[model samples]
Target: MSIQEARAATEQYLPGLIAELKHQGLMQLEHAEPAQLCQLFRRSNAAGLLIPQQYGGLGASPRDTINVLRAVGSLCPSLAVMMTMHHHTIATIVQLGGIIPAAEDLLRSIANNQLLLASAFAEGKPGSPIFNSSLKASAVDGGFVLRGTKKPCTMSHDMDVIVAGVACTDTGGVDHQGFAVIFAEGANITREPFWKTPILRATDSNALIFNDVFVPDEMVLLAEGANAEEIEASAQEASISGLCWFQLMVGASYLGAASALVELLVCKRGVQDTHLAQLAIELEGAHQALLGTAGTLEQRQEADAGLYSQALCSRFSVQAAIERASNLAVELLGGMSFIESEQVSYLLAASRAIGFHPISRTAAAPTLADFLRNTGSTVDAPEPAHV
Candidate 1:
C-alpha cells in the first residue's frame, strides 16, 4: 500500500489500544501479571499492529509504526518494548527477502493469528558482539542442527516463532551469518527465566536454550559466497534495510516513553513553558529524521552505504533527543513525579533504554569518527553493510 494509506490504516488501531489501556489503568498495568499482559495485548490486537494487511497485520509503514509505537509508549512502556522486539524480527525477515515457502506460511500465520515472534537475534554472552554468533549450526544432510542459547529472548511465553541469528558453515566450511526462523513449538527448545528487574518485569526476557534443534533448509536465510557477488549484494541490501527498520522502531518505542512524560507535564505544572518548548523542538527534529529515513526506505535507497550511516546516525540522535526530552519532563515535574507515582519511575527507566541496543553511540563512535575524517560528508559512505 501507499505510505498515506499505510499511515491512515495504522492510525485506526491506536484508539482501540489506547481505550484498552485506559480500562486497564496505570497502576494495574504497571503491575500486570505476565499472563494478563499477554491477554490484554491479544484483546487489543497489539500483535499484528505493525504487520501489513496483506499478511493479516495492520500493514503500518515506518512512519505509522513510529507514530503508533510512540502512542503506545505513552501509556505502557513494557508493551511498547515488547512490540518493538516482535516487529524487529518480523520486519527484518520481511525486509531481508528470499524467505522460503515455509517461512512465507509462518508470516501468514503471524498476520492471521496475531502470533508473536520473540527476537533471538544479536544476543549472546557478556561482551559478545551483536552481529557475530557462536551457535553450532552444523550443516547436515538436508538442513542444520543448532545448539546454543538466546539470552533475553522477549515474548518467550506467547511467541509463535523463534527467529535467531546464527553463524552457519557450508560443507566447504565457509562461514556465513544467517537468520533461523523456527516454529515456537519446534522441538528441543527450552525456556529459562533471566529477567530480575521490576521495571519491565512483564517482558518475557529470558534464555532460550536450543539443544540439537534441527532447523530444516526451508527456514534459513543466508548470504552466498563472495564469488556470487550478485547474491551477496542482495543479502547486503536486505541486511541494511532490516537494520534501519530495527533501529528506527526502537527509537520510536522510547520516544513514546518521553512523550508520555511530556503529556503529563503539559497537564500539570503549567509554568514550565521553556523546557516544554525546547523539548517540543527536539521531538520535532526526531520526527523529521524518522520521516526522512522512512522516505529513503520507501524510495528503495536501502542499498547505499551513506543511507546506512544516515540511518544509524539518525537512530543515535533520536535516542539522545528522547532521553533529553524525558529528563526535561522529569525536571519540570520535579521529584514528586517519581516520588508520587510508580508509573513515572517506569517512564524514566523506559526512556533510558537507548544505549541497551547494539550500535549505540558508545559502540558506533569510532566508526562514526572515522566516517567524519575519511568518508567525506555524512551521506557518502560506500560500505552499507559494514557501516
Candidate 2:
C-alpha cells in the first residue's frame, strides 16, 4: 500500500487508543503494571506502528509515526516513552538496509508477528564515549560468540527481541563493527533490574547481560570500519537518519506530555494569564518546529548529515520548551492545582525524560557546532559505533 493509504489506516487507530486508555483509568496511572500495559499495546496493534507494510505492519511514514506517538503520549506518556526505543531501533535497522541478514528477518518478524524489539545497545561504557560496547565477538565455526553487558536497555523484561551493537574481530584480525539482534527468550541473555527511576517507572529500562551468545554470520550487520579515520568519515553518514529520527520522535513524546498540561491551563484560565499565554505560544512553536522537521525527513530519499544538527537542535529546543511549560503550568495552577490533581506533577517528572536519550544537549553541542561551521565536517555519533 502507498504511504498515504497506510497513514489513513493508522489514523483510525489513534483516537481509540486515547479513549481506551482514558476509559480504563490507565492514562497517567501511577506505577502502571508493565505486563498489563504491554498487553494493552498488543491489543491496540501498536507493535506494528513502524513496521513495514509489505511485511504485514502499518509501515507509517516518519511524520505519521511521530504523530501517532505524540497522540499516544498525550494520554499515556509511559507507554509512549517505553516504545520510543522500539521505534528507534527498527527505524535504524530499516535505514541500514538488508546488510544484516539477521536484521532483515527480525524486521519481517516484527511486522508479521508484531514483536516488541527492545534496545540492548550500549550506554555508559567507558573510553568509547559513544554507544560503543565492550562486547567482544569471537569467530566460531559458523557464527560469533559475544559477551558483554548493555546498560539500561529499555523494556528489558517485556521485549520479545533484543538489538545491540558490538565490537567484533574478524578472521583478518580487523575489528569490524555492526549491530546484533537476538530473540530474548534464549539462554545466552540475562536481564538485570536497573531502571529505578520513579518518573519513567513503567519504562523497564534495565541491564542486559550476554553470555557466550552466538550470533550467526548473517545477523551481524557490517556498516563501518573500526578505525579513527574511517569512523570520523563514515559516522556522520550513518548519523543521517537513524539518530535524527530518534531526536524528532522522542522530542514529540515529551512535547505531548507538556501539551496536556498546557491544554488544562487554557481550559481553566482561558488566556487571562498573559505569562501563561506566552508560554503556550512557545510550546506551539516548539511543536511546529518538530512537525516540520519530521515532515522534511519523511520526504527525503537519502540521508542528509546536515539534518543531524537540525534534528538535535530541534529536540533540545522542544525539551527546554516542555520543561518551561511544565514549570509554568504548575506555578500558574498554584498549590490548589497540586492538591486537586497529580497529573501535572507526574507530567513535570516525565518532561525530564526529553534529556535522557543520548546525543543529549551537552553531547550534541560539539557536533552541532561543527555542523554549523561546516556541513562537510564529520561529527562522530554515539551510536552505531564502528569499533
Candidate 3:
C-alpha cells in the first residue's frame, strides 16, 4: 500500500488496540519481562509495522511507523518504546544498506516474527565525552574485532541484533573517519537492566557489554575511513525526518494518556473549574501542534525543510506536553494520582522518562537556546490579569 494508505490504516487500528490493551489488563501500569514484552509485540501486531515487504515488514514509510508507535504508546509507553527501538534497528540496517552478510536475514526474521533488534546508540552518561561512546573496532585480516560497553541500550534482553557505534581510537581524534558502525548478533552480547525508574519499566533500557566480538568483514555496516560524511548525511536526514516521527509519537502518547486522565476526572468529580478547563484547552493546542508537525514531516514538503525549526518545535512539544500532562493529571486526579495503580501515575512516569531519553535530550541546550533567541520580546508581551 501507499504510505498515505498505510498511515491511515495504522490510525484506524489504534482505538481497537487501545481497547484491547485495556481489556487485557496490559494497561495496569505493571512491569513486564523481556520475553513477555517481545511476545506482546507479536500479539499486538506491532512487530510487522515497519519491516519492508521484501523483507517481511509492513513496508510502511517512516510516517506509518510513527503512527503505529503512537498507537502503542497511547496504550502503553513501555511497549511503545520497546517497539520504537525495534523498528529503529530495522531502519538503521536499511540505512546502512542490507548488503551485510546476515543483515537481510535479520530483517526477514523481523518480518517473519523470528527476531527483534534494539538500538545501542547512547553510551555512558547523557552528554559526557567519555559517556558519549568509547566502543571501538579494529581492522583485522579476516574481519573486525568489536569491543566496548554501550550503556542504555534499548530492548537489550530479547533483541537478536544490535546496531551500535564505535569511535576509532587511532591517533587521529574524532574525525569523520574516526567511527565505525557495526551490527552484532545478540547472542555474543551481555546486558544489565536498568529498572529503578518508574516509567517504561519493561523497556529494559540497560547496559550492553561487547567483549572482543568478531564481526565478519561483511557484517561491518560502516567501516573506518569509509565515506563517513555520507553516512552522517543519511543519519541527519533520518534524524530530522525519520527519527522526528518517533518524537511525534512521544507527544501523541502523552496527549492520549492525559486524555484518559481527563476521562477519569469526569467520571469521578463531575465538571472541573474554569482554570482546569483552560488547561485542557492548552493541552489540546499542544496536541494539535504536534499532529500538524507530524503531517508536515510526513509530506516532506520543501517548506518543512526547516530542520532547526522542526527540531526546536519537537523539543518544545515534549517539554510542554510533559508539564501539561503532569499538571493536569495531578490537578484532576488529586492525591490519588500519585498511586501506582492510577493511570495518571504511569502516564506521568512515561512522559518524564521519554523526556530524558538520551537520543531525545541531546539537543536540550541548542533547542532551548534557539527557541529562546527567536521568541517575542518582554516589552510586547501581554500582562496577566489580576486573579
Best by lDDT: 1
The residue-by-residue lDDT of candidate 2 on 235-334, one tens digit each, is: 3355356777778878877877887777667677445667766775777778777878888887874457677778888898888888888888878877
TM-score of 2: 0.86
Q: Higher lDDT: candidate 1 or 2?
A: 1
- Tens digits of per-residue lDDT for model 3 on 1-387? 121232355656433555556665645534657577677667655665666678766676644554565455656667777776667556556544423556676667666864666666655365432114556777678766778787777676766666665554444654222223345453467677655675666777788788887776666644335655665665445434434554565555555455555545556665557745665665556655665676675476222235436644664665676577567656766775566455666666566655565444554566556656666443476788898
- lDDT of candidate 3 vs native? 0.58
Candidate 2's C-alpha runs over 4 A off are: 1-15, 26-30, 122-130, 170-174, 223-239, 269-273, 375-387
- For residues 36-66, write the lDDT of model 1, one tens digit per residue: 7767666767677656677777766677777
- What is the Cα-based TM-score of model 3? 0.77
Segments in model 3 whose C-alpha atoms lie over 4 Å from true places: 1-16, 26-29, 61-64, 98-106, 128-132, 170-186, 223-232, 239-242, 273-276, 301-305, 336-342, 359-362, 367-387
Sort the predicted structures by TM-score, highest score first: 1, 2, 3
**Least accurate 10 contiguous residues by lDDT in model 3:** 1-10
lDDT of 1: 0.72
